[model samples]
Target: MLIQTLAAAATTAAPQNKFGFVEALQAGGFIAYATVSILGIMSFGSFYILFTKFFEQQKIMRQGRDVGTSFWKAPSLRDGANKMDKNSAWRQLVDDGLAAEDQHGKMTDSMEAHDWLHGSLARSEASINARLAGGLPFLATVGATSPFIGLFGTVVGIYRALIAIGLAGSASIDKVAGPVGEALIMTALGLLVAVPAVLAYNWLQARNKRIAENLNGFSTDILANINSKGAVRPAAIAPAKSAAPAAAAPIKK
Candidate 1:
């Protein structure tokens, strides 16, 4: 009988959770839902850009490695370009350089062949850099604006709390807890959405800078090779030579 009475008393003493996430959202109504939806979209877009750009940068880096091995070893510019992946940025630069070289002869008497070729390759480099930079602005936007977006929800939540207090004639816990919780959720959500976006933006931007540097150096090398008519080539990256085994010791000691 004592155990049964204790169980009943324990059950009756436990308080219900009226100030939880669901309750807060329920109190905030349309404004809370809108904030969550917008944040969700921003988070999704940020991750998508991060993953896609990372893979793209990695592909270019791998292609950069292959340039010294497979590319410069070929007999001519045409042969070297054919050795690279056709869709690679390096291949595009080579094709543009070759095309420019072909057109340099057709320019008017006043235009120098070297200047025209240089200008063509520079334009090609700029275009590739621009293409690599395509989706970065969305990341920047999310990073910069997500906090304010969340703040808007917070402001609305606070306003609701104030209204509830006024209607109830006192600032009691029950009257204010839901809206206050909602406001905090908005602030936290804003931070969560913004941090990852800012991190991704910085990381991808750094990768792009590295790629651009590599592209510039490669472009310069290509121009020199083309101008010197296959006489110039960058150092080739040869595979490591295995150490030969020592001759077996004489059988007799």
Candidate 2:
């Protein structure tokens, strides 16, 4: 009788939890599904940005090597600019400097031409930096907000659990475990999503800073060259007015 009673008690004991993520999702309802979907999107977007930006930065860094060798070896500013990859940041800055030198004389009330050229280079550098920083804000948003979204789902799960308990009139392990597991899963998923986003944001930000620093240094070199060699005349300068032919003087001969 003792052995039989023990066997019956063991059989009645709660079965091992075969329940898992899918079951939790099924029990969590629409709110849980939505939360997971949003987190999934955030994760995908952050990873995509991280990878694309990494490749872009790597390309720029490699271009830096080319700039060091080929650009300086060229005979003139135009030649140096041509030696750089056409789409490179260094080439862009050089082009802007050349344009600024050409256009400075045309702007009424402009500062000294040197100052104008420097300002144009500065603006070009800023534009490149801004382009490099694109998509970073979205990573930051995901890092900052994903946890809250998860917490919101957790709250909903707990509320549902309470309702289930109330309806069943008993807080048995089976009734309580599924909802609690769902809530915990939501929290864990949130942390998982947020951690990568935050890491990627920081890593990408650091890389951007390095790129920006490189751009600033390159711009400075271009400005120095412009200052030393006098601005390269653009193809479009108007012919200098020839001094009216010395007023064909009376034939004093």
Each candidate's lDDT (Cα)?
0.90, 0.85
Q: lDDT tens digits, residues 1-253, model 2?
A: 9999999999889586545899989988888899999999999998999999899989988997777667766767788787778898878998999898889868889478778888999999999989999999999999999999999989988998899899999998788788888999989889999999999999989988988888887787777777778343322232355776666668865
lDDT (Cα, 0-100) at 73 in candidate 2: 61
> Which residue pairs come into collision in candidate 1?
none
lDDT of 1 by residue, 1-253 (tens): 9999999999999998988888888888888998989999999999999999999999999999998878887888899898888899999999999999998878677887778889999999999999999889999999999999999989998999899999999999988888888999999999999999999999999999999999998898889889988776665533356999999988985
Query: After TM-score superposition, what is the CA distance of residue 118 in candidate 1 from its true location, in Å?
Result: 1.1
Per-candidate alpha-carbon RMSD to the true structure: 7.3, 12.5
Tell me the lDDT of candidate 1. 0.90
Q: Model 1 compared with the native: what TM-score?
A: 0.88
The 10 consecutive residues of candidate 2 with the worst lDDT sum are: 230-239
Error of 1 at 99 (Å): 0.4
- Lowest summed lDDT window (length 10), candidate 1: 232-241
